[model samples]
Target chain A: MALLHRRLERSYSARSQGPLAAHARTLAVDAAERLGRLQPGNDFSAPLMVAVAVDLAQANAGATARELLERTLRLEPDCEPALLALGFSLERAAEHQQAAATYGRLVELRPDHHEGRLRLALNLIRTGRRPEGEAGLRGLLGAGTPTWVATLAAQELVRLLIAEERLEDAGEAARAALLRTPGDQRQWILLASILHSQGRRPEVLEALRALPAASRGVAPRARYSEWPDLGAAASQSRLGELARGAESRLAAALVEIGR
Target chain B: MTVARCVPLLALALAAAAPAAGADIWVTITAPREGEYAIGEVEIAAEVVARAEVAEVEFALDGRVVGTLVQPPYRLRVDLGGQSIAHRLAVTARDAEGGQATAEVSTLPPPIAADFEVELRQLYVSVSRDGERVLDLNGADFTITDEGVEQPLVTFARGDIPFTAVLLIDASGSMFGDKIRAATAGAATFIAGMKALDQAQVLVFSDQLLVRTPITDAKEILAAGLGGTEARGGTALTDSLFVALQLLEERQGRRVVILLSDGIDTHSVVDMEQASALARTSSALVYWIRFARDADNPFDDGGVTMTSAWRSSQEYGRQIELLTRAVRESGGEIIPIRRADEIAPVFLRILDELRSQYVLGYYPDDRRGDGRWHRVRVKVDAPGAEARAPRGYVDD
Candidate 1:
């Protein structure tokens, strides 16, 4: 009788475990389905969808990837990842504003996300937000960022500032960036630009001439060669002609150095 | 005074009996500017006595001989159509060398008629943050407010509508490396996406504008130009856009311009404000694609090393924003694409939006030629329908 009772208990325990496992699987599927249904079309709904999709996709229920993406967006429109995903999707779908908003949300959420930040910066550029977008990038670089991200961000920022005729700020930013990463060829070019804008002809020439030889950490040699050092001669001459007295003399000296 | 009056009446009676008449010469030159005139049509009229012997009259423009007419008190009209702008008109009459007299006439400036019309043809699409092919509605979506009242949309249509497109490429020296590749590719993609019947032109500008191909088959011209792109001059984006707008002005259908550049107007003769005005008046949509290098580093020296990139990117951002504003004001959108690979899909999406549009045309009751800009209003009477159309049209 005792043995029969033990056997019955064991059988019941095994049956109970089977149902519990099934329930867990069912819960996962349900979560995935909920996520998949959340397709948020706008900035407000993109992030939520992304987060849920990430969660579901991570769980090995690969089939729920789309569903997970959809549901989270349906719940919270402004979720960041969801926004990024939605932005990416919309971009793929050729919906620019919706995508821009998603990227903008990503920028708001993770300012340090370089990819997100870069994308937002680019979008802002496309939309004509020059100073603000550049300032954002400069702020990031000023925070002592590392390696390639810093290099790329600094290079782009300097070029834009120079183009916009913000010489003083460009000079300061370029100098600061150069101090941190001296091997950056773009920074050197930027320094030359600042000096040129400031009418420091000799300094500009020196800066260009002082550019280190193609080496580790410096910009590619091919890029450096494309700088048009000799091509700037006409502009330098024009600057010299425009300057009077000491300024002209200084410009001449710079021209000589450039030569 | 009474005697004088009687004498005048006597002379008038004698003149009436004889019906005596004299010749008067008048010349009219219908050119836009005094310094510049096309070699088109010039009208000259001379009133003369029935039996008067008017020797010869000579017409000249800018010291060069245009034509000569030898007839009594007669009207002569010269057609100088199809001539470029930069000519003048001077008329001289020579009954004899000693009796020769010359009359010079300066042409009036270009007319600013209120009845000017501009249409938005194609809207370029680009990928946004959410990975969707969307139109950038910055400067393009303008609200028409007449006397502080909002107007309604009269017509709206997508890609199915016939429109003119201009592709402006940057041949600036700074657009080197991957940018040149991407721009060419983007342009090719845009051309590929156009409908067979659609017309598009490709213009590459740096210090000057160069029209690589006129509005024709997108596939053939695009393929020929896309692979041979060379970057070697200062940026003149503003000037390029202005030229594109001018070209689009004569077009009957919708007009749009797609600009590919790094957003640096280094050597543009025209400023942003002027460009903006031209864009607004012409109602041309401007789509700017900014090419930026990827950021692989996140931290170094308080992020100072990234300043150059940041500033350039930001300037590009501002230019785009301004362009967006321009487009939106004209009921168009600004599309921004980051990845070069995104160009094709974005172009396709723009084409799709254009195709999906529903065009609604209506004739208003007010048809007075008042020589004024009139506001147009279009509204969706349906409960949930949306509408879009030109904010206004000029009525003359």
Candidate 2:
């Protein structure tokens, strides 16, 4: 019975360690164990236990995932995924600085990993490190990352530019993304937005009018009935005497636009 | 003496007879019509009391001398034509003693007509994003599906397309600390992503909607209001969103909304359902960002209760999910970012999505105003490629 129970427990633990659940559980257990071990001054087993915790956490466990992640750092202090995961977890924990340091370590360990770089940039952005974040995204884009990575990088760059009120630069980035991928609806919208912001009415109109036939059909139509029409005497009549003369004419024009 | 006194008294009594009074002269001049006469010829009529004689009468237009008349209740006609616009006419009548009175009238035309129209073209959009999606769609990977259909492709060209975007920032008190900072940073990033031709309006809301600034450069606007913001009220996401939609409806070109919030609506007058409906009916697209905080904070002194914060955060997440669904239904996308810094990248991704859409145009076969809503559907002729369009257009 004891052996059966032990086997059942092992099986349960193993099942829990499956790819989907392992990371979270591992993190939780690792955190719990590391704290326990650290308090007792058990430094020797800390690294190994923490490493195991990281592995479990990466496999997608629960509280254990975070616990293991912290334990791994307490033990080895430089496991890349542990650091990265810790940083991400820290960010999740709202410990932006700590997360940033973890992300920085991950970047240092694997400079070529675009995901790592991206994560680092994101952390930097959270910490108000605009320049670093911008540079990281730009570098990733220039490095010919995957379409998704590049897209994200480009987006980040463009967003930063826009935040800085560098519309021209933002426009350039948008154009670059468009050039790379012509079917992106968001890019087109952003481009159109930049043009509109600059008071380029004709160009803006042209852009809107030029929406792909597929998307154009979805564009909402003006509700003429709900809108006031000064051009229509009956409709204008509802406005009373105030709808007469120059004031009426102006009101009518407004109605036309509203429509 | 007595006899003299009696005679005097009798004389006085006889002299107690009688007495009387007399009269004066007054004259008045009147014209047949109530208007100003010219300088050449004129007509003057007079009315006299007690047989008084009329000495003279004079007329003028705008204080300029016209003519003089001398007659007693007599008619004299004067004509001076060729006047520009209108003038004020005055007449004076004088008696022998020079006692005179005056009267005047004014002549003018009616008001003129003016012909004028107001042109408002703002932009609005719907947005969505997923953290797990590996395909970083450049401007090319997106297919806009409107109203459960596909549309043709047109205006597929690239560059800085002009538009006006509204940045709706959630300023609820619950989004304190890093959440607020992240939101601010994200807002700044969105602003920085715009082109010079594009304008953005920033609206920050909690229980009430506060328009921080009208459409302007994203960076400057963000910088001005990002600081000194304390997220301490209920979320009025729906109201702010509605305002954005209205603004976009009035603007020309591509319209969009970049909603930066935790997606919790503690104080929204309009619920998510209504907001979704409004989004569907609007031409604008919405990009919702749901910022999630870490759940491991042991110290419970962060103003908001942990359970409430978590609940609110989860609610925000749910709202974001709903918003994402709304964007998808309206041919837009919702982006979720775990970190505050991811805000900028998310915005950029939205932009990329905007550019990559397939624009298709076609003249519909039906042109009748039968007051019916027409459904539009587009499909890719290419193998393995899908297409989408808006649901329908109302013909009234």
Candidate 3:
């Protein structure tokens, strides 16, 4: 029986994606359930349950997912992934304070967990604790933080400032993010957007025209290369495609600008 | 012969002689698929199969009539009453042949934050040359394809065809004062420009519905829908857009959805793929008037940046990708603006573009309900002329 369970695990791992993945996972989950039924539950059951919960959520089986996550948390209170998933679920359900608390537990378990920090901060903002949330986001911009996390932090901070009607602060934050990762595509777009928001059209055009091209062979993301990075996406169905190099993107932006 | 044996033989003979197909009505509940957590209000959709023509579909919630729908894509919105208990939702489709099909979905309490899948759509198009609207195009002037297979035209119109639109305004917390006002003004302007023949509804949302106006051409009603709303919640752009698409599905003629958002969807349960799926299904023109940068893909450091909420950076990236595709696929475009002030003009300009458009549509030769992305391309026969239509539709 144990060998069978192991085989199920191996099979699921082998087909973790594609059409057969879900079937493989269902088999693994059923095996896991049978194993739990036959043997005393232990630490092994918690992670397995968490994985099952993730699958359930993906399949739109949210109630079951929530219940499984709850059971998993009860068994292993410090499960980071479980905590994160529960927090997100709560946030989605519009229980911001509860979501924050769940995220708080994850943060306590792993202080450096990037998502935990971001979501906790976000919930704080939703609950009207803007300053605290802003501070939390600012902390993610520390030098030791991962580039991706920090970049997101910068973007969120800029967006928060922009939302708060501090246009200059938002622009400064965008520039600061650019300074951190000068070659980042999105930050440049952010900076250009800020200038445009301040009603500086010529400057917006200048800034975009100077956008650094995608770095050597960086696999173009769907949006970065093909998705209209600039122009009116509202219906570009009728407009022309603007893509690839910097100039093309600028021309797209120009279309939106009515320049 | 024994009497019992003779009866069994007669019944078997009658059953064997009966036609094997299309004898019974089939109404299958297709949405709220898992019935696990249907948070907020969900659109109950059902697929009905019947040999007889469907007369009407009665949507009942907890055994009460929610609405009577008369068509394929039988759908109706049901509020979950903010309960965490189980509830029974059923749909009964009655057809012209007097056959009835009944489908029911029991949604237990603790519903999701937002999820409602309803119906599907086709295509809208516009052609331009040298920075000007190419007004003189005809059905013969364009060629089209679906999923790389060329399709013949089914319908063609080049004038100001009547349309129904949904002005999806984001009144999330970030849009508190000026931003919300500007978005409202823009939506109002669009409503004002609507011809008596053209009707639209205003759907304002921030995590949940702030305001929803009935589909109408009355400017006063439209203005009232836009009047005085506070932006104090999280952004549920995808969920709100799903609702917008649902509204468009029931309308005839060209359907349009003009979304005013910052591209950040924090509280939506629908996510991007589902929203895009609904867009393709509704075949409505989606105009995204964006105000901010594309939300960052958290996958900058492999998967380390993934949010625990399962909105992993990878997921977020995929979300952004699908959303961009949804916009393009809807034969609509995104108009990115920096400030609140530019919103009203953009809305008016979109109205003008709607008027200038040449709507063209075609049925794919071998595509119907296969649930696949059929890439579409439209080419203008005239030199220097270019055409734009949605990238494709999901014939699911």
Candidate 4:
């Protein structure tokens, strides 16, 4: 029993010591026993049980995981770890609205938590609150925010702008991304495509010329399709067809320029 | 071991104690994740962690024993018909040696699916006299006819009643710059003007449909939703209209769709006919707010002088005729604005009209679900009063 408890405590934050089925069950039973003996109002019991639930849940025992988390929440509704795990579980189960609400609660409980806000924003966008989602993403990119979050925000912002057909803004965003990561073929292709969409043939040629010789051949296909918010009905058939036509358009333009 | 490590190990040994006599079993209710579920048969499954051989598992709801399984795969299904509210679900696992473990989960009722029966068909009727709403009227002062047959009014309510509205805004490329800003402001003004109980959703459509906000009464959230929308991509006017109607169909009370667009249909999977059919069938009223760049009086001849073939063939003529037909049939109106700033005023006027209107609902005497279009007519009894209502509905 002492060895099992020691293993559980040591494996709590270790990536290599992923919870095995037998070990997770043992840990869960041990945690449940400890929770049963602890004073009803003790603060440590809830987190201890939540950790055991997370471990069991990671071991393919989601039902056990959920039950444990729910039990902890019943005692301490503001338990951050339990709420975060439950929200993640609900999200994986495709219960987006419920998951979004859970994450929203997490945001309220821990207003300064970056991951909570990021997850809430994602769930909001997934459930069709585009404005709030976009605003939250932008908020996460503001000054003093984490660099990782800012990088992700920049990608999502550019994707959203391109989706809205704001090519001028998209071009600017793509150029900005290029400045951040110079010689990136992806940004060059995006800049060229945005110029093409705007019917600026000369600028498109200039963008193409700027790309490294090895990177220049086929124009980076503009994927203005795949609107996830629109659900499964948003097919990429039209965009795919347009991309195929673009390949030929680029070929012809290259011949005309004698490149 | 060092003294520090030895002290921690001693504390760990004190914390780990084996239970006396019978082994402790950890019981967990797994299925039916802690959330809401509508009234239906629910299957409850449980997991029992035990060192000893498990004997039986009992499933109960609200303290009543639902079922018990002696073998593995302990699961039970309970009909949750009468349980419309929150209830506690519990599962108890008992070993052969008499040791027992229990787990309980509480659940609330989920949102009812959209297919629920439409009990009352609420209509938002705007009665006007020379471009002004005549708000003072009783239930008996109005008459409703479905397919030319008079419908007995079961219920009647006047304005300030809760209404569910979908603000279908066009963020297409053509509606760039000032147009998008105007539409956003117009939508925000409309949302602000809604009654306390009123709810509105913002749906921005270009080639893609982006739901800015689901049904909500919070002005800040709705404003943020609208403000974040950027105008780009081709217009999918018909597709958006269809989606708006579909969304409003599931809502209760007075249902309305405030469609703000430039009256152009492009890049839509559905056509105007399908969209028109949907609007004709749905009880929700649709108001079209079209933006015109110039003073175009081509359809000023009351649509009588224009031939049917001409109306169908000419692009501008066809769009005008479609809008007129849609508005007239839905018992709504088409408000055309020449300037972006005028949109806020137009929205305010529409909001006023919404507040002054009456809702009338009646069950049809005819119950043949033959799926056919039924033309409707609404008349006002008071002097100098005119009633605007949906032109027809499909019996399905």
TM-score of each: 0.36, 0.35, 0.44, 0.42
Report DockQ per prediction, comma-separated. 0.02, 0.01, 0.02, 0.01
What CA RMSD would candidate 3 show? 30.0
Off by over 4 Å in 1: A1-259, B1-159, B292-321, B362-396
lDDT of 4 at B222: 84
DockQ (model 1, Cα): 0.02
- At residue B31, what lDDT does model 1 achieve? 26
TM-scores of chain B, in order: 0.51, 0.52, 0.64, 0.64
Give one digit per residue, the lDDT tens place, for model 4 in A8-60. 44455464554554565466456544654565655445555665566556565
Lowest lDDT sum, 10 consecutive residues, model 3 chain B, at B12-21
Q: Rate the local accuracy (lDDT) of all candidates.
A: 0.51, 0.52, 0.66, 0.64
Best by lDDT, which number?
Answer: 3
Per-residue error (Å), model 1, residue B208:
3.5
The residue-by-residue lDDT of candidate 3 on A1-259, one tens digit each, is 2223333444665666444555554564555455555664543454565655665665656677788778767666776767887776676555678889998998998998876797798788878889999999999987888665676667667767866879898888888878887875545555655664576867765665555543332211211111111112321222112112434565677899995
| Clash count per candidate | 131, 143, 31, 3
Worst 10 residues of 2 chain B by lDDT: B116-125
Model 3 off-target regions past 4 Å? A1-259, B1-122, B293-314
As for candidate 4, its clashing pairs are B329-B391, B331-B389, B331-B390
